[model samples]
Target: MTMSFGRFDLNLLRVFNAVMEERSVLRASQRICVSPTAVSHALARLRELLGDELFIRTSTGMQPTARSLAMAPLIREAWKSLEAAIDPPRFEPYKSNKRFTIAVSDFVTMVMVPDLLAQLRRDAPLVDLVIRPDSWIDLAEQMDLGQIDAAVGVFSEVPARFGSSSLFAYDDVLIASSSRRFGKLSLETFSHLSIAVVSLHGQHEGVVNGFVAERGLMRRSEMFDRAAFERTFTGSKRSPRVALSLPHFLALPSLLEGTDLTAIVPRPLAKLLVRSHPLSLYELPYQTGLEKVSILWPAWNAGKAPQDWLRAILIRAAEPLSANLFDFVRPARYASPTSQQEVAASA
Candidate 1:
């Protein structure tokens, strides 16, 4: 079972990779903390063993030969596989000082960041988190390019190459003023009434509009889709009656206060808003169904220690978000103050 290469030093591959990455023997030696002569000798031996030029000297720098270029990727992949196989599959939360970047929607960030930071502080205290607004088209690409470690939100479309896990589900509820008229909210009432919209991309039309369209509410849909028809509705004159269109869900409470603006917010956020502010929650005429939120990572990151740590923390944080909205297992017996605690802890 003991097979070995005859007079071939596998360490040369490491030198080759370093030089290829650095494009200069001197730089490669500096990177690997070795002498320039040692790097040159390793490259010479490698060129002879492979029977190819491997690298050609140019005015700009050392350019990789066709043969070296073809072999470099395979060599790197092999080294990665070998290292992964030898390492234990455990991420040390307290010891790691790694910086993790995550792409998330503004709504999810508003709801989950506090608790996430709290948990991170208690556990991996030194680790830093960088959050950026992730868009649908570029989410997977960002993960693929190593731009971000993970993403979280209501993902309408995700590439099959990426890995995703559903953290929790919550219902979207309508929040209106306490004095607003109810009992079968009519299209006239729906159309005439001003509304506050929260969108990550400053969109006027969203889930609520889609739900209204499903019910064949034409005039109401048009009102909801005002952004699309803005040109036709106000061709030459500016419409002054339209209320504020904000980006963050947290801003809705202040926008709605002393005004009759309505907004459809996630149930957890809606409850949190009502509890903290002078807002009221209303039962909508139709249900927009439960919104499922999930954390996504690159497929290449599966079984990775860093990915595992992030996943476990997120899943733990999502427990509170799922408790009140669904008939699922409660994180604890009493859901009110604790539920709010859970929400705030992850804030």
Candidate 2:
């Protein structure tokens, strides 16, 4: 029972992984293109060698034991490392039917996804994309477990094990219904009006002074520049009240139309919304620092061809928008009604 590494079979790991993923002996056999009898024999050999029942048959399905649960992640990571070492480093985007999963915010989906999809369709017709919300509490864990390939958003802190690249930078701007014919948004007037904000966690407060630390990941749960808002109203008696806290931007336009509610959002997203909706963009009464939107991936995937290819496409897609971001953030007083349309067209 005390077998050395030299005598241990590596193929058994493949069978184990298949069973672990499928959670059923018959399904696992089908996944590996092996007969159920061979899968059963392999499992038996592994169980005997390890002195543990890795999985137990139950009414639901093949349930993994405590030992299996403990070993699964390590075994899977080891197999991935082995495969990466043995396999040739190449990715043919045009011919291969590969699927990539990305975690993104709704703002990024609105501004960037269309261009990304257009380029992807032209360059890699067979490649597929799966988009997940960035608000998931387990986003970092999912990335570590290989369930998510990459994420796009503003990360306050990225662990050293991950690699990041800035796609673009933006600042905050205020938006209101154009019908209001609002003049300059002085600090006093801005503080008096009701405000709407896109809060991923539905938090009422707009002041996110620092990152929300959760499970080894540092993320921004609030969408707007809350710290700047707090600084602008440090000692004011009538501070701005967040009248609405919505989860996504889809309902923001309808909610703001013909209403006194104004929202503080990223400059780029504000420009996009103003072009289509009856919204008017305004410069924040107080200056806010710029925030960079970035894409993050596992550090180990740095030179992998698939990751490199996807990164290249993403950078190319964002280049035009990045170049014109300054136009979107210009002072609202100096901007003309048609400026939003022109900038949006160029982007």
Candidate 3:
């Protein structure tokens, strides 16, 4: 039932977009400031014009069908263009109350958000922040669906179609209990020792895993660089032994306690861990190269005023960061060395 272009009204698309975002006809009506009856009428016209049951009412809510899911992103993009064309661009953070959602890894949540939140408090008091766990969100799809404003973490690769900014760069390092006889480790010791590799899947296992299970997509949570690790011992016969794998980093301090296992973690995390516990940080004998964490957003979001402001704030915050604060007995550059504590405290 493809209708002739002459009979179509663009307002029908707006109604459809609102419903898709809210996932409820009643809530969608409130979002658009219209009545539920009017929403139903517009939806009926849209269904007839599109020749598909766009949404099916169920016990849960207005569940979008296959056709609706397929068309939602396209329609959202069109509606955004329409709004931009008709409405003048203006965003005042102090006066405007808008919610911004960011998809981030546990690493960023632990290391970046503290400073970011403090800055937001002074600058955008009216704006609200929502943090989505990146390991559980199909970040690429979430950005496409307009569910997340931006993604922040170390990514191996981000699709070229999206917009991104490099926030900070970091390398991996080795962490172990201080009491261990091995004051410093050699390549041979590294290969024989039991290692704990952080697996994102292991962190968000049962109930938490279900957060993304309902959606048909997958995300890579762990940030280990196996390629770089193996490349260091290219010609050597000794291979590293992996004894255990856990998902989150917060527990590594306790897990490595009284055990012969050493955990590999980002140098920034190593900085924080050594401060709180009787732990030692050492340079990796194998060269797991630097990973640059970036803030990625949808192309549709590029140049949007409020989003741009927030992005700028993140870029500024990451300016003075360096992950290898504990690389030596005293930070090579930080003569005072206490500045390492200052950087760790920033996180």
Candidate 4:
């Protein structure tokens, strides 16, 4: 246990790291560009030196032992440090097969990822993307530990060493079925009808802002604005009724069909969804202002060209969404011919 650092071969440790990640000697050998026998030998040496089985091959896979699990983080951290020091930072999307992991909301996945995937196929065909869920996870901590490459959402309070860039601005819009009765929707008309709201946090919790404020990470949970909804009518005896609360946007379309339920959601999302469904969008009756969507990454990843390049691509994809975001999600005073045309097209 007290062997000198010089006695341990770093190469064997690298093999240990690879086996831990790949969980198979053959796969680890392929990753390290060595033979399976060499990989197995390295693992054996490491197990002997560390005085633990390190990994046990089971029916499922090569499962790391308790000690291996305990030491995995330190091993990964050490490997990362070595790569930072010695590996030349390079990313050639066309030729490189690097996998990037990003944390984003389901809304973004629906609206933006199509364009992103198309562009990636055209440009960086070999590059791969791993999409992770945005909320509930510690965004900053995950990025720091290399679990997440970038985070794209409404990041409210980014912790130190994390980077962010504004992607676009969107406003909350009221989604209603075109068939739903109302020649002209008024505060009185809206007050009595049941509404659907996307719950940011599921059954157990709720927050003022979309992101979990308790965790100190700034991701969005802009499902509904209670204050804005309440403020829509100043002297009304009753507030707007919320009949349903769902966890995600996927079910909104089905839930709104053939019903009087109206949902308040982001303008960009509403616009995209209405194109296929018989839905209509209206500006929030009250002035709630624009909500910003942003791209977030670790500052340590800033100087790396591949990371920066991908960030640039994502920002580019979001540009067109923001250009006309304010036009339709605006107050009634800003109604123009173009806005009318957009609304008509959506309806």
Candidate 5:
């Protein structure tokens, strides 16, 4: 008797990819536009065929098991190849009618909106574009699930597992009334002076907070010293102070003018405010260096036509405003998806 291999369902990989990408069966069903029952059945078939449970249920969604961990990269690569094989042969930038959705913070929008819009109008005139405001959204997850075409902003909330690359760097500069300098500021100055800060989530505990706290503690420690340096300056013990906490970066400029209050903002915003409002941009006495902004996407989208096209457009649009002008940096482009074997080995 001749031995023959049974044919396996190829669509099962699509179901598995969706689940792996979204990390939730219900969300995966939504992405694939199939019923949850259908998704579950497809996943069950995949589990039996691969002899792995794939993902174990968790409070924070499904966590991939060791076996599933070892299979994800292969699945991703297969999907990329499948997409390439099935994709339309040609894409006419000006003629093809496709809508793209992008997520970006208002700060990024303020800088790149004009040029991005102009480029779209000239190159992909018929292509519809939707610009969604940045929120506390899981952009990487969303990209993996085909929820958004691309994101243009800082990925501070992105998880380490996701691949990302730097788009550019901009400094965070201090702004205050020119005449309101209090000689040399002590941490006690923090207790006296009101400062404006920006955070998208409205939770102020990242770089800005860390820098301030470190300075505050250092200043407090130095106050007790009897050195000549301590004698040269008068200081006191006081709590860190924040008078008016503004959530939006745009509102800081108007709030700082003519007031004793000071605001720390991105260098570009500070420059704009200095030109518009009666504000002076001063380098923070503390050395919080320049900020680096990045663009991120799912590793699986590397070879897909739509994703490849979108990334190319973004890079092209961002090129003219390179390091010389906006201190842009070429981000690490992951040409291949991270293998599941690698992930499993790391674990």
Candidate 6:
């Protein structure tokens, strides 16, 4: 049965989309900032108008019917069109008071946020930032629902529907305490030392895959290049032993001070660690391939003014750091000729 456009309430589509996204009445209500009863009432009106059950409550949550499933994409597209029409074409960052939510790992936060925040303060004083953890399993859904504006990390593969921009490329380096004396950091020496690693997913032995498959989304989980470490010791009988696995980089200074434990960290982070702590940085024995970090957003938001402005500022903030990522690492006195050659290439 076809219903007249005049009688059908457009507002009901908002509630419907919320329900479809959340799959629970309570969650839908919270998402739309309405009472549960209001969501239920709106669903009832929508069901009656369309002459379909629309949603059925099961043991899990609200299950959309065939008709609801068919209508969802159309409704979502219409909402996107309406939103674009309502949003201003030009964004004046200095005068606009907008809060942007971003998802980033602790590592990226430590390295990039200070610079990004300073730029924001100078350029967009009224703008605010809400940072969410990048380890969230449902991050893709959150971005799709417009809850998160963008995410920054070393993503393995970004889906076609999302747009991404490269922020910087980084390679891995090994760090140890300055108090400890060490010879050339050959694979044998690297394997013998007790190793500390930054593992966001908490895998103790093997390297975590760049992306984990969850809910049909390729969510980024791992941070370190454990694969390179493992590959360096592939044929050796003795493998590198992991003495510690940490979720963050904050305690590395104290953790490695006056100890034999060494860590493999990103070159950018290694540079920061060495400057502030009594740490010595050494080039990795094997070349750990460079990983490119990027900022990802839903493709529909590509041409939007606020998103464009945010991306522009982010690129600007990372420029100085990225320009010197490979240049900052000073090779140890016992470094191999390869390490010296690598340094020269950066120059």
The candidate maximizing lDDT is 2
The Cα local distance difference test for each model comes to 0.64, 0.81, 0.73, 0.75, 0.60, 0.79
Please give, for residues 173-245, the per-residue lDDT of candidate 5 as tens digits. 4567655655444444544556666656454342242221221110011101113212333364553344665
Best by TM-score: 2
Clashes of 4: 2
The digit string of per-residue lDDT tens for model 2 on 172-194 reads 88888877755666778778888
User: Cα lDDT of model 1 overall?
Assistant: 0.64
RMSD of each: 10.3, 3.7, 5.1, 4.5, 13.5, 5.0
TM-score per prediction, in order, is: 0.61, 0.84, 0.83, 0.76, 0.60, 0.81
Superposed model 6: Cα runs more than 4 Å off? 1-7, 17-40, 49-74, 203-210, 325-347
Q: lDDT tens string, model 4, 162-226?
A: 78899888777677776764544566666777888876565435455445653356566656666
Q: Write the per-residue lDDT of candidate 6 for residues 1-347, one digit (tens) a residue.
A: 77899977888999999998889999999988999999999999998888999999999999989898778757876887897889758789999899998988888888899899999999999999999987643677777666788988877767777899889888877888877656567777776888888766565332236556543456445556767777878888898788988877778889898888888788787766676677777867777777888888888788888999998888887887689766635555236322323333443
Better of 2 and 6 by lDDT: 2
Q: Return the candidate ranking by lDDT, descending.
A: 2, 6, 4, 3, 1, 5
TM-score preference between candidates 3 and 4, better one: 3
The count of backbone overlaps in candidate 2 is 0
Candidate 5 lDDT for residue 43? 82
Q: Supply every candidate's count of residue pairs whose N, Cα or C atoms clash at under 3 angstroms.
A: 6, 0, 0, 2, 0, 0
- So what's the TM-score on candidate 6? 0.81
Model 5 has an lDDT value of 0.60
**After superposition on all CA atoms, how large is the RMSD of candidate 2?**
3.7
Which residue pairs show collisions in model 5? none
Error of 1 at 38 (Å): 15
Where does model 2 exceed 4 Å of error? 16-30, 35-74, 203-210, 328-347
